[model samples]
Target chain A: MTAVPDPTAELPVAIAARPAPGLGALFLTCLKIGLLSFGGGLSGWLYQEFVARNRWISDEDFASSLAISQMLPGANVVNLVICMGDELRGLAGSVACVLGFLVGPFFAVIALSALFDSLPDVTMLEAASNGVAYAALGLLLVICLKGVQRATKFPPGLVVIAAVAIAVGLLKLPLIPLVLVIAPVSVALAWRRS
Target chain B: MRDDDLVTLIAVFVPFSLLSIGGGSAIIAGIQHESVAVHGWISSREFIDLFAISRAAPGPGTMLATLIGWKVAGWWGALAASLALFLPSSLLCYGVIKVSNAHKAKRWHKAMREGLAPVGVGLVIAGVISIFRLSGGGLVAAAIAVASAAILTWMPRFPTLGILVLGAATTSALYSLGD
Candidate 1:
């Protein structure tokens, strides 16, 4: 994971993908993510930064991290941050990333709550925030579409995706049990396709 | 500011943290149950208001824990609740990554990686649904979402912040004019 641009290394070797993000860069990147990410779709934003723009992690690594983070019990965004942070710079890197991610909203929520009583029109804010959430959903849908197209290449992948979406999204089934039932079949199919 | 209040906040959120499979939205109802019905930290009305507040603020909606903690006590309560809510699962995640990461370049790992990709897609779809539901199923919201999606699809380099601002501005203008 350490991809720091080494000065002494020969330039004739494989071209460096990008400079490895140091702890400070990780914190700032995550901090920017925390502040800028209004609504949800945070995973998409992280993908844009780490995979598309920065070349910090490959597309496949991001995909696998998404899988791991979603499977584990926590904030999907937070879990991804931890996984990528650890991969980037070990335990301390994870700490910086997590703290950077949480710190902005920690104070923002409290401060906003204090102002909650003072606002003249909560409904107006509601209208605006609803708009924000809606737009964020659009961004998320784009990523969802991309993920679907990629997953379809593997056999039975589209079937698993549709089944899980129906069960969890429409039926509102509890995630753990649904995943428990679906995961083994999904993994086995992927193995066969491989 | 009571010590017991801090302890209570911790006691309540720790369980929700681990139980929050799929993400923070998963345990929102549970958090509501405990905070409103069980602990009486806040009323149901306050819960709704804070939910909006957390949503509007620039972070995860789960930061409702911070608002509730602030309401229950003050800054210290907010700190306590935030820690309790975020820490346990984080440690568990850290441990899991540390262990599973021990093996790499294996065939099973590749299978796990490929298999999990669709699962995340399933999750993104579910999140889109739940959040749509949360917004009272507004057709206007649906239109705005579709518009923004199209915008991003074509101009992948378009600044997202601009989209969000435009969304807020458009809705706010429409609502005020309608009113």
Candidate 2:
């Protein structure tokens, strides 16, 4: 599984049609991003590697993938990887990218679990972790604000943000029902505006 | 790991994955309900700790599944839980992307994207509030969060890990001094 994708083999016409990078290169790049990124800035790491450094995808393509990722479910970073992988190298590439991205953290979290078990008395470690968690909230708040700015081009977009915050955040309604109710309304409004 | 436990992991996470519509934040309450109350895999306090650790760890915040599974049933459980939560949603996404690509310029696609953008933002804000509450909503925690947000807004290029380390060191020093 760790073998490099053959650079010279006759790739299937489907894969050959796209300006695809080797699966090995895609996996390694994902692995590097996974291992190096910390404290919840995975997207920033992804943007740097895929868009800025390597130019594997253009800025617009990255933004579009990010939009799709956000619009769908699960983790935005994971979805983003899936979209990038699909675009670059199809289904196998998508699987490889996800595995590459997740493998490091999978092992790291297991190691952390072991460490937590051993350091039962490390009150300071707990405190530091709390600090980091709270700080990550700060990062999240900025991202939310930026997202709001992006969404507000249409007038009803602000309304959707407020309604969702109230319904899901304050009212504590469960999300699936809330989304089922609000999503259609927001989409209709967007359709009208369009 | 017990076979029953593996089955339970699958049953709990698969539905949660489908419900994770906006992102990981959307399903936090559901996961908490299942893991802490319904299944009794971990205590509520332990749930919070795992949440914090998962948040602070690299990779997706959804790795909380891996941690929860690891805690409950070792490596096999971790494997089962992560796949259950991740696989279905990803496959759905792949399918949707394929369909959406065919209709790339359709008005409905635009509407869907526009409609969901704000909801995605709202979910993230809710996440911030939840984390703030989890951190005990202390004046120091609030101050750190607000200050960090302000600084990051001012300097969009600031290194996030640097800010994380700064927050940790500053809080740790305060606790040491208090003690």
Candidate 3:
């Protein structure tokens, strides 16, 4: 696409102004996220690392990336990394991020599976892992709360949130359709509020 | 690794990659069906083992595909399967992001971000419930999760690794006692 130069187009420039982290740092960060997020809540940990720690992007950007990732086809966390990585450093950034994210688990899962196969007792081990999950949920909860806080000052946003939770979480609706229906309403509400 | 089995891995996972809406969990059932009932790469029992292992291991739950490939055809198979599963959707997501970036200056960008933020939060909560249920972590797990969340919120500086370690210790001790 040809670049349409617009004088008012300042938001992109400001967001893009944040110093790009080196590929190695990007890789390391993702590696930490991948290996450490054993019980889930990878996205929350991702928020903690990227937006919260490094200040790479605004909280709104992170949440929006997450929402976009959810609508797309792929693992939500991986898709999230892709979006954030792209924002940070273009294509190469995304490559480094996704590889760093996946490479550790590739080896760890194989090795752990081998270990599990050989070992006689994993009951305690399983319990421990579940414990890790229980705690990891805490991390996710914090991030979710933060996202919820950022989302709504108006009641409409709350309605959107409740609708999503009920339709998907309670009634077990498919996400894409729900998103297609809910997203427009949300965008409209946000448009009005903004 | 047999060439044919590798081909099968690619064919099976590529579609599922695109089908993985929301997250990797969306395709788990289809993956299981293909591997176990259709191709017979592994039995039903073995699929469960791999699922359990994927959960226990770090990274995306879709690493279940990686594990399946590892079992079916070895390292090359694992690589092929994972690439097939993740690459297509990654490309699509990347394109969408690029477009979104191009429109970064638009007024709607702010509105879209704000609007989707709540939806994202809701999906996140839904995901939390599902992941927690999958673990069958029970009441003790529930209590620990809430307590841990409280502690983390209160003390943002607290190291994550320490909390996780504490969780393991606490839960394992309780489990051993109950047993």
Candidate 4:
């Protein structure tokens, strides 16, 4: 019989894979992710941290984890934190991850709320925000395109679904009705093909 | 507010946390149902406005929990609502991670990923469409979306805050001109 490839041997020797991060480091990383994650780059950042930077997980595993996070309830990023924490350090890690992720945003929101009075009247601030919104839309589009490229092996069906969905949405069709119509048809096609 | 009111607020948000499948936007319907239809905490117009603010805010859209909580029950309420919205799902996710690690490379895990990807794409597209709709159908809004998409594709190095500020300024300037 041919020798089976050793998975462990394939691991990068240059990158020392430590055990899960300590509570403080975990908290700090999560906080940084939270603060820096403007307009939702949280998933990409998580992939970089856990998979590319830390080498704690593989890309396939990260993709799968992200999938599960999206499927589950709560914010996808928060779910991912729990997933990563549990994988690394069990229960306490999970708690720490959640706390770390939420703390920065929570305080930031509270602080911003206090500044409600001046928010609308501040023209420069409004101008800055408008710029941010435009950039956010760009970031969001890139993320979506990347996601589409990754997920779709069958380009034809994928393009069709994307185009149809975009059309319906732009036409001002109600979301619920569109979902009800497209979801089942897509599932049926997938089922039949499988 | 009374203790019962606090409990009711928590009850509304807790289930919402669980049912929010896609993210903050996914829970909008549920939030509207509970806050407007059932409890009468906020009117439809107010709910819609709150959604706009949440989307425009610099942080997670779920920060609406804090806003609604503050409206309903002051500081304590805000804290409670935020926790309730986040904790259950966070714990559930932790549980999922534990189970997934134990069952890595299993067929079900792979299958679940395959199934979720399309659904997620659909959901996200739907969300974008809905946001566009909410911005109101106009050449200006369409131009904004198209121009934003093109600029982002070309020069992603541009800060997001800068883009949003520009959009708001353009809109405000146009509005002023119309007056």
Over 4 Å off in model 3, which ranges?
A: A1-18
Query: What tens-digit string does per-residue lDDT give for candidate 2 at B77-126?
Result: 99998999899989988987888767868888777766666666666666
Model 1, span B121-149: residue lDDT tens: 78778878887887784888899888987
DockQ winner between 1 and 3, please give it: 1
State the lDDT of candidate 4 residue by residue for B1-179, as single tens digits.
Answer: 67877788788899989888757778878888888888898899877766655654545789788777877888788888898898888777766667766766775545544444554554455555565555453566656656665654454444444554556666667666765
lDDT of 4 by residue, A1-194 (tens): 78665444334323555576788888887887676555444564565466545677544345445546766789877887787787777788778877888887777666666675346776555444544444345444544554565556655447545754575556655444554565555545544455
For each candidate in the order shown, give its overall lDDT on alpha carbons. Answer: 0.81, 0.75, 0.85, 0.64
**Per-residue alpha-carbon lDDT of candidate 2 for residues A54-137, written as tens digits (9 for 90 to 100):** 557654355446656766778888898998888788888898899899988888777776777687587897678667666666
The residue-by-residue lDDT of candidate 3 on B94-123, one tens digit each, is 998888879888989889988888888888
List pairs with backbone clashes in candidate 2.
none
Q: What clash count goes with each model?
A: 0, 0, 0, 22
- Residue-by-residue lDDT tens digits, candidate 3, A1-194: 78655433232312443587988899999998888888777887887788655668777778778889999999999999999889888999999999999999988888878987899988899889889999988877876777666555577877887788878877889889989999999999889877
TM-score of 1: 0.89
List of clashing residue pairs for candidate 1: none
Give the DockQ of candidate 3: 0.51
Candidate 3 lands at a TM-score of 0.92
Q: DockQ for every model, please.
A: 0.54, 0.40, 0.51, 0.27
- Interface RMSD measured for model 4: 5.6
- Winner on lDDT between 3 and 4 is 3
